[model samples]
Every structure is written in C-alpha cells, then in structure tokens.
Target: MATTFQKCKTDEKNKAYPCASTRCKHPWTVRYREPGGRSGRQREKSFPTKTEAVDHGVKMENDKREGTYIDPKRGAVPLKVYAEKWIGRQHMATNTEGTYERAFRLHIYPALGSRLLSAIRTDDIEQLGRDMTTAGLSANSADAYLTPLRSVCKAAVVNGDIGRNPFIGAKLPKLPNKAVDETQLPTGQQIQDMADEFRPEWALSIWLMAGLGLRTGEMLGLRIGDFQEDHVRVSRQITRGKAGQGPVIGPLKHRRVGDWRKIPLPTNLRDAVRAHVAAYGTGPDGALFKTLTGTLVAASDYATHFKKVTKLLGFEWSPHDLRHWFASTALSNGLPLLDVSRWLGHKSINETADTYGHLTPDSTGRAVKVMDVAITQHRAGLVLDTAA
Candidate 1:
C-alpha cells in the first residue's frame, strides 16, 4: 500500500493555532490558542484527510521531545547574547582573567560576531583556522583564539541549545615545537661585561634574572620582607595587567607547599639589592620596585628598563633568556638535573632534563677510567669479574 502525508487545519475556534492537515474532505481546519498566553487564537488550515492531520500532530510531538524543532516564524538569536551568558558562568582564576578577556575581544567577537548561533558550523570554524594561518598568526596563537569558541559551543551543547559542538571536527593548524634558543644566553664573561657597563641598579636585576633564574614577574614582585640576610623567600609574584586584576599574590607556578625554600643571595647581588632598597625604600606599600612617580612598577616598564640595560651593554637578548642561561650554564657546569630543577622551582626533574638535554656531554673519559680500574682489579684477583 502507498502512503501519502497531507497538510491540514484543525477544528476548535477558541484554540485557533494552525496545523497543516485536516479531517474534512473539503476544508477541515484546526484552531489552537497561543502557547503560554491569552492572546488571539492562531489557526491552521486545509487538511483533506483525517490521517494527514493525525500524522502531523505526532511529528510535532516528537520534534518537541528531540529539541530539533523550531517555530518557523521565530528568528535566530545573536552570538553576543550567548557569549555574555558564557562569560558570566566562567569561574576563571585570577591570573587567567586577563587572558580570557583578551581572547574574547581580539578573537571570538571579531571572527564569529555576525553569524547566527544556530547557523555556525564546523566549516566556519575550519575557515577561521585557515584565515588565521593566512594572516600570519602562529599555530599556537590561532589555537588559543579558537579554544574559547570551543568552550562556548560545548556549553551550548550541554544546555541542549545545540546538538553538537562544531569545533570538535574542525581541523587545526600544526603548532611549532618550542625549544630554548641557545644564542640568547649570555656567556659568563658577557654577564660580567654587562654588569660593568650598566648602572648598579639596572645591572642588579639583570644579574638576578640571569644568575638566579627568577621570572620578571617574581623579580618585580619582590618585597623588602621577601629578602633576608641569607636567602630570599619567593612567596608572591607580580602578574602583568591592570589594577584590581586578581592573582596578584599567588604561589609560584608548579610550586608545592614544602617546595617554597629560600635561595641564598650571593654577596654581590645581596649588596646591590640592599643599596637599591636604601636608595628607594618601600614606595607607598613597601613595594621593592616602583616607577619614577613612586608607584608599583608594571612588568612592561621593568622589561623596558631591562632591555635598555642589555642594549647599553650591547647584548641583544630578552630578560627570559637569562633564565635559560641559568639553566644551561648550570647543566654545562655539571649540576645534576634534579638539583637544577629544585633550584629553578620546576615541578619535576624531567622538565630540567627536557629543557637542557642538549647540554649533556659524552663523558667517555670518565667511563674509560672506570673500565680500566675494573679490569686491573679483576686481573689482580681483588674483585669479581662480573663480565665473565
């Protein structure tokens, strides 16, 4: 038997909502009241057969359960509305708020601003990746931009607003592997030369960064109280951004409770830090580093000064390069990876090994010496011949 679906209208004038199929042969109509209100009844018209009307009703009921159905007349919602809702629900850490804000302003809104939330597809996400790559954005940067959108879309799916996350199937660009650039590290002699060329105040900070491997944020966050006669306690670090920004005084990255130990201050560095403090004691709230206007210095300002000092010394490197130098130099000087990891506040020794693996030498002479001693002892009958 062949089956046909028909469009129809329902009876009931007071409840005059329109339906596609009707029971009457000539012009059966269905009427239903507006949903959730006492507004005027909406009417649907013209079903030639009773079977057609029943099938339409069954389909509507199924669509409501599956959440695939949308009223044809109601329009789509804008993306910005959903974005605001997502932001409000986000429980971001203090250090991460600025990053989220930047991602929203620079990436998400600009790329997907005009698109309807319902119409966004995986192809749209893939196109975003391609366009970002074409525009010279690094693969990592492009990924960062897309990550927030993925989160937003995931939220939509969880809430039943959408069926699936579009970003799940989108192809992303390949990210470059990050390795330390050895050229950036200054040699021991170069460090001395820079210290000699720059003012004591400027040189001191550079020396700490290069010699002690302190992050710029940690350096700027140093307080008078953090420094003792023997060692410095790295309890807090300065995060870059505007005032009232959270995470101003959080523990060091990957730092465990017992891991926060004191780093002994070298004689020269200790003296220089003392002198700088004597000259510029606690600003308003006892901050160690401050601006000319006597306010806490921003990280960018510290970086500017660092660059100026490095330039004056004729060294073309970033402040972070000094930390790399510290790690590399320590490894080259035969410091064990575990010791270096602890000194640099790394989470694990594996991190040190991975970062400084290139610095390891063959140690063939030491191995040969051990082998010779073992052979002589074995021949002299002083030791057991394990090789035999």
Candidate 2:
C-alpha cells in the first residue's frame, strides 16, 4: 500500500500504536515502506494539528515516489566523519590540499565538528563566519577558512546527505582594497636609482624582476640555459609542497611539462645578467641566481634579506612589488595589455586587464578623436554639396 498518515493519541500502555485518549501526550504517526522493501515502517512525530501531519506525510510520499527521499537516519553521520571522507576524495595539488586542511583544522572543526551532517542549518553556517571574525581573523582570512566548508557542503549535497547547501546564499565579508596608487611603478629614473642604491650582488636580480614581472618561484627557477639570444624561457619553478615538507622544484604553476613562457630580454637587463654571471657564477645545476655558498636561493632567505634592505632604504616594498612595477611599466608604455599578459605568463588577458587596467591608455580621449574626425569629414561633404 501507498504511504499514509494517521492521527494517534499515545499513552504509556501503548506507545507504538494509536490510543484514543484526548489527554495522551503524543499524537501523530506516518506509515511508509522503505525503498525496495516489502515490510512497512512507521514513525511517530509530534504535530500540533492533523492537517500539518497530513501535509508532511504527502510530501514524504511524493519524495519517495520521485526517488529523492533521504532517510533521515542516513544523514545522521557526524560532520567530522563526512568531512574527512570528502576531503580524502578531492584530487588537488599538494599545496592546495595542505591549505584546505589547515583551514579545516583552524576554523571549521572546532565549531561544527560534532554536529550531525543533517542537523546543520544555514544559521549555523552564518554563525561559523561570525565565530571566525570573533576569533580575530581578518575578513580575507575568515573567507579563506570558509571556502573549504562551502566545498564540503557542496559535496554533501551531491552525496544526498543534505538537500541543499546551507551556505549557498551566504555572503563572505568584503576585503578592503589595499592596492598602491601609481600609474607606472617607479619610473625609469627611479628604477635606475634603486638599481644603483641596491647592494651590488642583488642589483641584477632586482633588475630582472622589474624587467620580466616573474613570480618569485619563477625568478628563482631560472637557469643559465633558460636565457637565450633575445628572450628568457620560463618552464619550471620551486615552491613549498605539502605541509611540513620543504620547498620542491616542479613544473611552472598552472602548466604542464614543456609548457613555458618566453619573454623578450631588455638590453639593460641582459647587460646586468651578463655582468652578474661573470662575477658570481651559476649554481651546480646552472641556476642563474644562487646563494654565496652556491645553493639554490631559498624564498625565505630572500624575503628576510629583502626586508632588511628595504627597511634600511626606508622603502616599503616586497619582491612581488617589482613584478607589479614591470606590469605597470609595460602597460603605460603603450604595450598591448594582452601581450603584457602573455609575457608575464598570466592565465588570461582579462587577468592582465584587471591587474593593470589603470595604466592602459585613455580610451575616452581616443574615442573623442575618432568622433571629431568623422564630424569634420561630414562637414566638408556638406560644404562641397553646397558649392555643387
């Protein structure tokens, strides 16, 4: 028979079956057979009115018929268990996995780890954001932690543990824009001054970074052979691997084997590299830049040294600031934004525009010039017509 609901009065003598006493504490029951089962199952729930019970039973019946019913018991697994399984099934880079794991341990686990998967509601997820803020996480940091939780919830929806993602409509906190205001990062004169003032040993690397706009790993990954007649090849990088593991040499970020970018070599940067190579020599594997002891340059070491140098000069900058300077210089020099993006190995031109759009030539003035020419031509045509 089809699923059905009945109003029942319950008492201590007959709790499972219905009793007719009006004073009975519990009142409603629904009878439904599990999918692919011959026997029936009955569940008792408290309902204020028979109409509410009937409506709920009808919805359950429809869900079962549509093969979308999720037995509440099936989702009773604790969130901690589900999250572990979900994270295990993810195929991601080791560094990304480490990041996700860190976020889970730092923010997600402590708040909702003990709750059942089905018991969590939208309000609970909202409270998680609030709790992260209360714990003194910045807006960006809190959002980073919440990213893994959102992914986990999405997986749960696919697994039928939840009908919908609770965090779907929730908004993450906004981060304030902290970008520096400059059309082109330090002009030609300023760059020359910085190069002159920087330590002799480090000047070449600074010039290369400002010239090529390479990421830190990419800059450190360069080998003598990568520099050719008129360009530099970018095919490899060194970056931190999984948590606790140190730096690892690997393929360039977001690329596969043999996928490399080639950027034109500027004359000044080429001269600096040639001079630096003559003075210091390459690493064992021909790394262009190496420590005094001839080992691969570590990012941590570079950061420490750069910080001290910039502090001494009273300049507020990081290694990455040089790359931004390169992009800004390229854009402001009338180079095509798309070309600049390719040279910098950006994933797309849109990324290039978003990062350095402010440095692009003024489109409004160009449009006005075009319109002026068109209007001038039209007026000349009218003058000729009158003379004819």
Candidate 3:
C-alpha cells in the first residue's frame, strides 16, 4: 500500500497551518491505503508536525515491506478486557475455565487490569512476580497465576495486538524439584487401617482408591454402569468450580470428552463393591457412591468423612495419599512401570517415573550377589576344563 503526508486545514478559516504551530495540536495527517478489493480504502491519521507525519508514513511503508506493521490502536484494549475475551474463546473444561477465571481475578487483574496491552513492560511483570512472592505465595502458585497471563500475552502477540510478550523473559521464582517426596506419603498399613476404619457404607470407595491409584475426582465420578463384572471404566471426573459453585462433573483429565480407561478389578475389591451396591442403591445420577440424599458424592464431603475415620484410627492422610500408597505398593510388587502409569491414568510414563521411580527398592546388593555367582560358575567351569 502507498503512503503520504498532508497538512490539516482549519475548517472555519480554510487555511493550511504551517508545521510546528504551537497552538495547532494536530497539525499534519498521514495518509495510507489499506489492502482491499478494487482501489483499496484510504486510511489517515494526524500527527503533531509534517516531518513527524512523513517519518511515520515512511516507517509504515517499511513495515509493510517487512510484513510487521501493527496498527497502534490495536492494543489500546485493557489487559482485563482482552483477557476476558480470550478466556471466552477457549473451549476448556468447566474446572479449567474456573481456574483461569480465578487466576485472572486473584492475580492478573489486581496488578495489570487497567493497563493497555501495548503499555505493559517487562518490569511490570517482574514487579508482579515480586508482589506475589511478598504476599506469601509459593513459586508454584505464582507460576500458576502467570500461566494464563502468559497464554493471553502470547495470543495477543499472535493477534498482532502487541509486538511481543513482556513476560517472555521476565524473571520469576525458580520452581522447586518436581519429584514426589515419598516421605510425605502414607504407608500401606496406614492406608489399610484407614480403609478398615471407614464406615461400612464408604469402605469400598476407600479400598478402591488405595488399591487402584485412581484420583479422588475419578473415584467420585464413578457410576454403577461404568463397572463390569471384571473391570471398571474411568470416563469422567468431578471437581470443584470457583469457591461457592460446588463440585462439577466433567471428563477425565488429559482426555477428550467420552474417552475412558478400563482397569481390571481385583477380586476382593469387586466383592466389596458388590456388597456396597446391595446395601446402597445407585445415586440419582447412577453414581456408585452417593450421599443419603441420592446425589453424587462431593470430594469435600468425602474428605470430611475420611478425616473423621482416620482421626478415629489414630492417623491422618488426604484421600490422595491412598493413591500414593497404591503406586509405591505396585512398584514394589514387581508391576511394570508402564502398566502402573496407565492404571494411574498419567499423561506420560515420564511423569509416573519421576514421581515414583525413587520409591522403587534399591537393588545394588542383589546386583553384587548375582555378579558373584556368575564369577564363581565361570571359575568352576575353568577348573573342570583343566582337570579334564
């Protein structure tokens, strides 16, 4: 597209004012043509002076040649408004949407909401990180807050609303190691005791979690129809949406809607499930575990019951600790790492290995013993050969 610079004439006087008029706020207008059908439409903007207008028009031409021109007004939208539109466009799960919305409300909006997309700077991002740290947020929590912000900034860059992401290279708190510290995990005995102590009505669910490594969400979302004679299918999960909205049922994490995993049922667990079913009919939603009111069980309610049971048993652990117990027990019992990973519904084998690999029993002593036996056999064969 072609570009030009022109002087703006005073309408009443019908006279073109010279550049550098202290009184004339908008003395010059830069004119350019945009790409359009048949003799593209002309677009223009006013500047403070003719020289400045000409420079801007030439820069626009150069930018057009390089395919990097972004209209200055494109990023005039505030961060909060742009973030809201961006969030709306995403086809995320209900819980994920709530998480992003919560992040925006609690982290991004308070610090950068009113700032225009184009006006945000790297220092502003750094300052925000510092503020979050000063407010006693962990590195992981701060990064969680920054995640949606980074995604939105990248989208803005892609939409040509901003030249680049200000937070791209900004300093953030260093995340700690990702390994699951087994020291915090509950022992198998503790798990068994907790399960044994649970009210008969909730005992089967507790046993399933401790044995199968299923997430709390997956366990609560289970329905009677999802279970077969030999195995149970994991197709959906439940999660709490923003604070007061309560638990929401949705597809399993890292899976498409309607996708599922089938886990082989243990004989004892199947019997327990059968007994539980006989005592308590399916919930209104056909859920295997339900409250007295026949609604699908809420995780918080389960936790309350679990805490009460553990306290009575003289121990304490989150429901998720049951899954940890399963992973450690399975790995110790010679189950293949890959199978354990699938049973846990992990997105990748590496994730499973990173979390539980260290928990696998050490084999250095066994390795030495095996090597010693091999060496002894080799010497015995040499001695027999020589004697023969």
Candidate 4:
C-alpha cells in the first residue's frame, strides 16, 4: 500500500483538512491506518505555501514523539482555569487561599484571562505590568498581579503544555522601598484628637491599631474567647473576598509558633471589649466586630468609617498608622529593643530596632553620656596629665 497526502479544499463540501497558518490558513485531509485494525481520516492545517504547512506539520509530529505537544483542538487553556487548579494544589491555609483567590479574581484574571497560555510572552507580562502601573495600581500591587500568573506559567511547564515559562526573565516594575510617610505614626495630639472623634467602638479599634500594633484584619478577627487573663490571642484574621464569596476566617498572617505577643490589655480597653461582647456577642462564632446585621465586619466598612472620623478630627493618619504609633511610642518611652520586639510580636529585636530605632533619642543620648562618663573617669585617674 502507498501512503498518500492530498491537498484539502477551502469549501465545506470538498471538506479537506484545515490550515494552521494564521494567514491563508486552510485544512488538509489525510486517511491513515491506526496501530489497531481501525482506519481514520485526520485533517491537518493547510498553509498557502505547502512547504510552510509541511514544516509546521513535521515539527508538530516531532513534538508528539517528544511528549511536548498540545493538541490545537484542545486549545490553550485560559489562565483562569489553570489558576483555579493551581490554587487548589497549594497547601495554603484558609486565609491564604482566600487572599490568593481574591488577588487572582480581582487582579490577574482581568489582566490576562483572554490570552492563551502558550501565547503569553514575556512582553505580554511586561506590558500587563506596565498597564497596571499606568492605571494607578501601586507598584506593590502590580507585582502582586504577577504572582498568580507566574504560578500558572510554571504549572503549564510542568504539564509540558508549554516549552518555557515566559515570566522567567520578565522585568517587573520596581516597587518603592521607602516606608509610606503619610501612614506613619501620628503625633500625640493627632492621636488624642482622632480618638475623641470616634464612637467608643471605632475609637477602640483605632486605639488597638495604634496603641496595640494589631493588624486591621487581626483586630477585626478577634473574639471574646481569644482574650486571656491579661493578653489578647492573635490566632486568626478576617479576609474579604469577591462577588458572593463571604469573608473568610483564617490564621494570623505570617504566623509562627512564638509569633504571638501578650501585651497587657489596658483596663479601659478590656472593659470596653467585655462590654461590647456582653451587649453584642452573637454567641461563640459572633465576631468581635460586626455590622448591624451581626455579620463579619468588612475591612472596607471600618476603613471607610475610620477615614470619615479622621477627616472630621483633622487627623492625617490611616488605620495602619496605629501600628506605627505603637512602635514609636514604645521606643520613645525607653522600652528596650528586645522588650519592644516581644511586645510587637516581631520575630527579632533587630526588626524592631530597624523600624523604630530612630525614635529612641533618649537611648542615643544615654549612650553618649555613658561614653562621656567613661572618658571623664579615665581623665580623672590620669596622674599629673596637665603637668606633663
């Protein structure tokens, strides 16, 4: 028997194989025997130039043997599908999964969902990042959009769906390394004024953030049961999700075994928390903070309300500024770096010192004084130094 290759027709009646060429693309028809007793007809893409079409066909055949080929008929899976699968494979905690899912839905999918996985190039990713930057997304946020995409590309490579990960050498925009000055610690007067402007609940929220260094999510995630004899346990956080997905409760961010701090709860704050719990506790699962409906309070809810309060009070601080306030206050009050680190739940004193060391003017002055005293003592012990 002779193997025959026949040119396919452009029209449906002639019914030949379709061409894979983007321009002048058509299909070619072939009848071939299977390894079994069955015979079948396969249609391949037809190219205007036979050689070009044959070349692509040959390469595709070779890829089939090398196990590096994906059927065009299957099409390139969209990034969204791969992302969902990848997230499922991740051993992330509940909160982490929630956060990643939110980032994917809100950021990555909107940017790159329509493109085929194989069609994604470094240029595409770079441009996507640029577009995000141009659209007023922060550098950090733009970089965040890349995280899910990178994961998807890697998965494609592992599955042999694509030859190389395009994001491998992609250049992302540089994020600002400087701490945000506008959200930095508030002045004493500013804190007092801001506190005075809020209702008891909102004021306490601000106080915990600035006064206790609790993350906003952590503060909202707290329950009455988490309070101990003297300290509040930081074991979980509240995260918001997109669409109909409700807020998820998960473990503390960057949590470690010894990550929890046991700062003494102020008497007033403790009393307020107890009172609020007594008055509004929705039972065991009842969140410490909630809307009028008794549901988990969204970060947006508190942030928007806090902003209004701050505006009314003429304070220029953000909710996170409370953390800075706590750190700065501790350092300025002569708290040792190690103690401050423990109080702030920092992994190390070095981290604490790096962030608030400049606030320790008194410590610096004391170091100078100790050096001066040592020099004075050395001079006093010198015999006839002036008679020399």
RMSD vs true structure, all candidates = 8.6, 4.8, 6.0, 7.9
lDDT of 4: 0.68
Clashes of 2: 0
Instruction: Give lDDT tens digits, candidate 3, residues 30-119.
Output: 777644434855678777777788887887777767778777678999999999999889999887877888888898999999999899
Judged by whole-model lDDT over C-alpha atoms, candidate 3 comes out at 0.82
Q: Name the candidate that leads on lDDT.
A: 3
lDDT of 4 by residue, 78-182 (tens): 877767777777877666666677777776788787777777789988988898899999898888767767877887788767778898888889977433343
TM-scores, one per candidate: 0.65, 0.75, 0.75, 0.67
Give per-residue lDDT, candidate 2, residue 74.
61
The TM-score measured for candidate 1 stands at 0.65
Minimal lDDT window, size 10, model 2:
1-10
lDDT of each: 0.67, 0.76, 0.82, 0.68
Give one digit per residue, the lDDT tens place, for model 2 in 219-275.
Answer: 888888888878998888766666666655666766765689999998777777888
- Candidate 1 deviation (Cα RMSD): 8.6
The list of candidate 3 runs beyond 4 A from truth reads 1-65, 196-200, 242-245, 304-316, 360-388
Which should have the higher TM-score, number 2 or number 4? 2
RMSD of 2: 4.8
Query: What's the C-alpha lDDT at position 101 in model 2?
Result: 81
